[model samples]
Target: MDTSRLLRTTTTVIAAAGLLLTGCTTGGSGKLQTAASSAQPSPDPTALRPYYEQKLTWRECGVPGFQCSTMKAPLDYANPGSGQDVDIAVSRRVATGPGKKLGSLVVNPGGPGGSGIGYLQAYAGIGYPAPVRARYDMVSFDPRGVQRSSPVECLTGPEMDKYTQVDQTPDDAAERAELVAAFKEFAAGCRARSERVLPHVSTVDAARDMDLLRGVLGDEKLNYVGASYGTFLGATYADLFPGRVGRLVLDGAMDPARPSLDLNRDQTAGFDTAFTSFAKDCAKQPDCPLGNGSPEEVGERLKDFFRKLDAQPVASGDPARPLGEALATTGVIAALYDESAWPQLREALRSAMNGDGAGLLALADSYYERGADGKYANLMFANAAVNCLDQPPAFSGPDAVDSALPSFEKASPVFGAGLAWAALNCAYWPVKATGTAKELVAKGAPPIVVVGTTRDPATPYRWAQALAGQLDSGTLLTYDGDGHTAYGRGSDCIDSAINRYLLEGKPPQDGTKC
Candidate 1:
């Protein structure tokens, strides 16, 4: 039960290339400047000139037709002269040109942890519409504290396996204590292994890094596409450098206006909505595993299965690792990210119920970015790092989670308890939060497109609405469909609208429904 802000994009990446994977004001000279140049009213741009003026020497990476490079950004923006820098990993596929070239279209598949470079190489660079790709370079970067970018390391593969198995829904005081201990151990591991970058990995730091990247890339204005948590990051950039915004699209948006608890509860409800949609579709299938009365009945059946696993774990082909309640719940939530995964979920459920938990375990493994080599990627570590720094913990302790249970349960009977408990992980973070929940109204920015899926499981549609309304010039593009992000998930209307926006700088009409 990681933070709900975790993007479904990683699952998309896993399904595609098999790789596992957030603001402020305006300022000076409308030219590409240092990262911290215009972050404030009148900053000492000369101090950071080396970083902004540094050239990126892109070379062919392993990925065909793509180039990789590294950009340098200050480790701490508050004190640029500290001499510590984080090498941000970047990737790009230069425009295939049959049209006039637009500036770089930087893209992000939001995990706060998702590898933007992986997303670019795997999908965005190749799968994006040809016209848009022909006009603009498809670029992405693994933000600071993310994969290939001084990533935060917490636990070893085996330790993570044990951590994931920790009971999220504690039924007694002992279980609750165990949960807390697990969280403390996890936090301690982060502090011990990656303490230096932990406090500086806030969204603000990343946004400033983006500005530096923009300067290095020679892009006066950043044209971009960001999904899930990426939306929050892009919005933050717009708020900070409203005048530097080019054509921007934020799909599957998150509302920065909401507090952590509200976001967790909202995302829980969103998952319930996705599960109901999945269950309804399953009911129509002849071999629906949960049976066919109604969504609630199906949910109850699933809950019963989880309870059974809690009592006695099921075999998952690995003698050392068994399918427990936590992993099984993660597997189910993983499948709910995309409707195309529903059939796989059904089969996983059917097999799990019959005592073979291999399929569900595989799904859970993919969600965790655990490779066949028994190693885990830094996705989860960076996720907690950025999420915990971005806002205060949703729950101060077990008692706080208990107090919020009723509201969470009312929102999602199936996932409420686990998600509520999941919110408690940040409470034990070593560093206090540096960011506060606030509405981002990029007041002077140009029209930015915000895409929303009606039944997005991870980022609810209302969040998109809220974000669009918050931005002074945001235009809401609604996809009356399912899944997480709308733009590249097989919706021509959605894709075309975004493509048009990216290529021609013409956003769709406000309130347009696809």
Candidate 2:
């Protein structure tokens, strides 16, 4: 159970791959228009000139058409002369064009820990709508402390395997203590291994890094598509450099004004909403594991199953790692990210109930990005680093979580207790938060499109509504559907609207619903 406010975008990729076997703020006018000329000089301090002017020598790397490069940014933006710098890993696929080429369209798939370069090379660069790709260069970068960009390392694979197995929904003081200790151990590992990069991995810093990338890419304005936590990153960029904003799309948006606890609670409710949807769907399926019942009954049964696991673990295929409540819950949450994964989740649940925990364990491993070799990706490590630095802990201690458990449970009867406890992980972070909840108006930016799916489990639809209302020029586009994000998920309505905006600079009408 990861404690981050937003799930990594890669979760969808992982979930889909597993199933393959089985299954922001307004300003200005409400209407989007062509961005101001890129020829206009930036208002950034002169101290950053070198970073802004640095050239990227891209060379072929991963896939056929994609190129990878390293970008340099100051480790500490306030002290560019500190001698310490971070190299941001970047990738791009130049426009395959017949039409006039638009500027680069930077994308972030939102892990704060997620590998933007990996996402670019894997999907966005090659899989995006070709018409849009024909006009704009598809670009992305690993944010500082992510992947090749001075990644934050925490536990070893064995250590992480043990950490994930720690019981998230503690039943007593001893269990609670164990959970806290696990969080402390994780944080200590990060401090010990990644101290140099840990303190500098805040979203604000990443947003500034985007500006540097923009200048290096020779774009006067930053055109972008940011999903999940990437939405927050995009919103931060717009807030910091509204003058440079161009055709920005924040899908599966986060409300910047929500405090950490509220965000957690809301997200808890979101998962419950998604689970209810899943339960309803499962009830209709012949092989539904929980059996036919109301969504509420289904949730209760699932909780009962978790309690059973809490008492006695199940055998997973890996002898070293048995399936427990934590991993099983994570597995369920991972499947909830995509409705298409429902069938997979159904089968996994059935298998888990039948004593074979491999299916659920596999889902959990995917969520954690654990390779078959048992090596875990840096996604979770960077996730905690950035999330802890971005906002204060949702709860200060176990007692706080206990007190708030009722609210969380009220929000989500099934996922609440575990998620509430999971939220406590940030309380032990080695670095204090450098940011806080606040509205991002991006006052001078042109119209930016904010898309929200009605049943997004990780990012609630209300957040999109709040963010759109907060932005002075925000235009809200709604997909009355399920899943984590709306775009690129088979919704022609959502895709066309975003494509039109990217290619023609005309945002969907404000409050448009598809």
Candidate 3:
């Protein structure tokens, strides 16, 4: 996963041609300005009042239990009257109350690109604890440039197929040039296809949009559960509107203070940690392909596999496209999200080592959400757009990457180089970053809960510790287990504490261990 993750999500929409989206700007200090710390509400500018006051008409859509709605937010909040509105796609499942209802409990499954509406409809609506689901209207909305919302588009399917296959670990000048061109091509395509919506899709802008959603939903205060990148988004919301915050849960939280380089390096180390755990578990299996080696040797063996794939891509049942190092690594990363996927990863790797790349390719395709028809979800496109606009580039060029290589390699000898190169993708972005890496205290907000799985591969546990320490009233819930987000993954302790927090406003004790 890029520090800017592609965990899971998708969407569709065309940006209007040649609209002026660059009026709003950031100082590019590489750190975001902290939101106002006071509990006092900020007055809404007159021109933007209409947006906050508009009535949303909800109608049934998608799964049977959910209602869908559309919202309009200014493409540029600074100039609300600009007449460029981006449609926000929202979905809700009304409370099936047996007790007093809580206004609304919004959930986000952190892609920076995850379709919040899809998450609501597919999992949060019906997947949450029935007791919790019974009292709060479960709601979610795709952020401005996510699925169903006015999404950002980049390359076509074939182009993306080509892009993902480009040799990430460049062995020669031609291969290095190909990697650079792939990043450039992707950046250029996004600019060409999404110029109007690109600049306004920053994290700050998305945070502002969440506030609008709160008012339009008639909630006096926002109740939110955000995981992964959503943690950053929700923290921004709480920081911006501390007075309007109710109970917020930031699970698998991110450390907003880390610059892109450190974030990526930490994440590279995170994947290394997760992979080591996987190797330990695999060694116990009778058919473990890694052959009971030490974790260090296992890592080198995996790296060796990747190098071999880079040299001679394996046939994946598709003649036009074979599984290369990039896709194989993505396949491995996808499995790291949840330990349940570990067995599948083991099988995939076993096959890949034997020269049949189909299983690994399938896993990679699933990670990218590519369909049999070769169409891709807008996940990666919007992920890059939001990420690029949130922070300055991690590396300016190949030379900069070379200089940073040792540190990254120290972070994760297996994944460092690829992730470092992946960071370079943002350097070529068309829009200047409008958000920054900054501490968020959300001073006046009610007690907020932050959950961290000890062996989480995406947003490491230390990030949760950092975020919890930063928030004035933040409490840390530790899950000494494996996987990404912990709440609904079968930890009674985690779920019970969070449930109590959301229901009775009784936050778990700080430093609570599950």
Best by lDDT: 1
Give the higher-lDDT candidate: 2 or 3: 2
Once fitted onto the true fold, the runs of candidate 2 whose alpha carbons sit more than 4 angstroms away are: 10-44
Off by over 4 Å in 1: 10-43
**TM accuracy, model 3:** 0.93
Instruction: By lDDT, rank the candidates, best first.
Output: 1, 2, 3
Q: What are the root-mean-square deviations of the candidates from the true structure over C-alphas?
A: 3.8, 6.2, 6.3
lDDT values, one for every candidate: 0.85, 0.84, 0.80
Clash tally, candidates in order: 4, 8, 2
lDDT of 2 by residue, 415-481 (tens): 9999999899899998888788889898978999999999999999999999999887999999999
lDDT of 2: 0.84
Instruction: Report model 1's TM-score to 2 decimal places.
Output: 0.95
Candidate 3 deviant stretches above 4 angstroms: 1-4, 7-44
Tell me which of candidates 1 and 2 scores higher on lDDT: 1
- Tens-digit per-residue lDDT, 298-385, candidate 3: 8888999998888888989988789889889888887877788889889999998998999988877877767789988787899999
Query: Which ranking of candidates, highest TM-score first?
Result: 1, 2, 3
Lowest lDDT block of 10, candidate 3: 12-21
> Considering every candidate listed, which one attains the maximal TM-score?
1
Candidates 2 and 3 compared by TM-score, better number: 2
Higher-ranked by lDDT: 1 or 3: 1
Per-model TM against the reference: 0.95, 0.94, 0.93
Q: Residue pairs in steric clash, candidate 3? A: 11-147, 32-436
